[model samples]
Target: MNDTGRQSRHLGIHIDRTVGEVYAYASDPANLPAWAHGLGGSMERVGDRWVAESSPMGRIEVAFVPRNELGVLDHHVTLPSGETVHNPVRVIADGAGSEVVFTVRRQPGTSDADFERDASAVAADLARLKEVLEFD
Candidate 1:
């Protein structure tokens, strides 16, 4: 699929942890509620999928890619409206530490203000992730 017309912004934060350490923690859907507030404040594992009932966007479903060594933490978020948004996340080595990057793409009908709000939420979530991994 051609994505040339899609507007995307990559938001990232540096973490005081190794790539493996960050990947292992962030790639686990069970650990999301603690750090990924952008997804929701509460999450539960139901069968093979993680369900978030208190998400800002209402009840949603999240499905992450299978574990891998390449630091790919990509996931799919199924919105309350049944629209699935593809979130591309990655953890990469940065010397002795690592950096986590999340790509926020503006949906077809999303307004500029909403897109920025979404970006801010992702940024906050990344900050929280760093705090959890580095200090907690």
Candidate 2:
């Protein structure tokens, strides 16, 4: 939660593994295209930052702090009216498993319907990730 009343939707699961092992798999940029649906391009390192291109989301920039066990991904998508919506994803490790939180703050004059749609997409992505990591 933040001052803007924009709270993230947090998802969590516990795995029978060490935090480091789970973190390694989750933080690997190369694994994104395998589990993440819309990511089409490879993740490359630009100095200390990571960037990936997606067909649906365009270019996304990510920053990670391994010591703090935090990651942030920032991206934008255009609406039907040509308005851009910002989507931020925050990833953190709680214990054996990790917690993934997604936040979407609507642009000025944007409707809540758009936010709901984006949130559903995020949920789907997370669900896919869980299936890949846990079952596969």
Q: Considering every candidate listed, which one attains the maximal TM-score?
A: 1
Report the Cα lDDT for residue 84, model 1: 93
Error of 1 at 94 (Å): 0.5
* Tens-digit lDDT track of model 2 for 1-136: 3333354444444444455555566667567666656554577767665567554666755544443344444444443344545656555566656665556454444356765675666667777766777778
Q: Rate the local accuracy (lDDT) of all candidates.
A: 0.91, 0.57
TM-score of each: 0.93, 0.60
Off by over 4 Å in 1: 1-5
Q: What is the lDDT of residue 105 in candidate 2?
A: 59
Clash list (residue pairs), candidate 1:
none
Q: Write the per-residue lDDT of candidate 1 for residues 7-126, one digit (tens) a residue.
A: 999999999999999999998888999998867888889877899999988999999989998999999999999999999999999889999999999888788788899899899999
Model 1 vs. true fold: TM = 0.93
Cand. 2 TM to true fold: 0.60
Give the residue spans of candidate 2 off by over 4 A: 1-8, 11-18, 67-99, 103-109
